[model samples]
Target: MNGTEEIGCCGAYCGTCREYLKTCKGCKPGYLDGSRDQSRAKCRMKKCCLTRGHITCGDCGEYESCETIQSFLSHPGYKYGKYRQALEFIRAHGHAAFLNAAKHWTNAYGRYPEQDP
Candidate 1:
């Protein structure tokens, strides 16, 4: 299987999730065609880790006690269990864990990830 098949426990594709794509863009060291506005997916993990000096959620100093992470989890419509599962999976299996658990948070509770307007 090509890299895309390496599924994440969160039901995400490690190879194509916007965060990974952002990492790819980081490699190129330039703004992707329209990433400045488009392609800015609303994943807290990606946003926090990329913009807030965290390499991974598990690496955060607050870890099990982080308010940002906990607040996100408290939102029932957001599927806290699944998100935590993904985080736990990442802690255990690294990025590969997201493959199985990468279920989209965007679709939960009839909510699609909101795009910046």
Candidate 2:
């Protein structure tokens, strides 16, 4: 793990996303590779957090009301409930702790073993 996997700015676990090793390196690079959806590189949620100098929206003071994050989470295509769980865990336990726990679970394609059926 590159240690960048657990801290996706909008709360998804890059370590567990199919794009992690192939197309994306998570929000920290601002989706620099452009292999996923090209528009994802311009994600408002990631841009908002980075522009504010935050590691993740969970680190932000206004995370709850941040329209960008709220909209992302509300998208019907957003199926990762673990994203919210990861955010809460990060907020309560810290990023390092989340990373350590996540390390045991990420599969090659980047989805957790238990999550993929």
Q: What C-alpha lDDT values do all the predictions have?
A: 0.45, 0.64
lDDT of 2 by residue, 1-117 (tens): 257534677666666667765776667653334444534456787767766777678889887787777667666653445566667667877777667677776542123323221
lDDT of 1 at 86: 53
Q: On a 0 to 100 scale, what is the lDDT of residue 55 in model 1?
A: 39
TM-score of 1: 0.44
lDDT of 1 by residue, 19-85 (tens): 6545443311122233454236455554564454443455466767877677766678545665565
Q: Which candidate number has the best lDDT? A: 2
Badly placed stretches (over 4 Å) of model 2 are 16-18, 30-41, 107-117
Give the range of the ten consecutive residues with the poorest summed lDDT in model 2.
Answer: 108-117
